[model samples]
Target: MVERVVATEEAIQLINKLKSIHGPLMFHQSGGCCDGSSPMCYQEGELKVGASDVLLGHIGGSPFYIAADQYAYWKHTQLIIDVVNGRGGMFSLEGPEGKRFLTRSRVFTEEERKELQL
Candidate 1:
């Protein structure tokens, strides 16, 4: 099962907003540039949680779901999804702060930021 690190209030708010539009909030941690992980928001039908899937605690009372395939990578990972207020709905991730992994993906995009209302 995947564990949940302490999430910030901004992170919880973003999750709540995503959950309102979608059914639940789903993200995954996989091999990336650095020895760290990157969180990617998935659409409702994009996630495939199974019996072996881990049910991590909620963020701001919103259920955070992680797929079974991503459990191993997230075991010791610290994921913090925070919103950059007054920044055009931009969000930030703070954990290991590994520059390699953060740069691997365009984690934050103008369109995505606006969509999530970050």
Candidate 2:
């Protein structure tokens, strides 16, 4: 069985706020800068899950989904997403043994940060 890391309380609140306007929250990770880690939120139906998909449970009542392949890689990963205050939003992942990586974006503008608040 695949293990799932629960979304933090802050993440849950942020996702709920986004769902109020955008509907279900969609999550995806991909190979990119900062040790091959990336995560983004989109409007409902923006993401398509394949047969091998893994349901990661809901974050603040919003369905949180992820790809099976990606889950395999993130099995023991920890993610921290922040949007509160004016510090912009960022996504970071740390492996089981403390290895960590941040999103590729050097800095997020006000609008961009708000858009990806969750």
Top lDDT: which candidate number?
A: 2
Q: Which stretches in model 2 have alpha-carbon errors above 4 Å?
A: 1-3, 31-36, 76-118
| Local accuracy of candidate 1 as per-residue lDDT tens digits, 2-33 | 32444555566666666676665555443343
**lDDT of candidate 2 over 79-107, digit per residue (tens):** 44433332221432112213222222234
Clashing residue pairs in candidate 2, if any? none
- TM-scores across all candidates? 0.42, 0.50
Q: Looking at model 2, which ten-residue stretch has the lowest summed lDDT?
A: 92-101
| lDDT score for residue 29 of model 2 | 51
TM-score of 2: 0.50
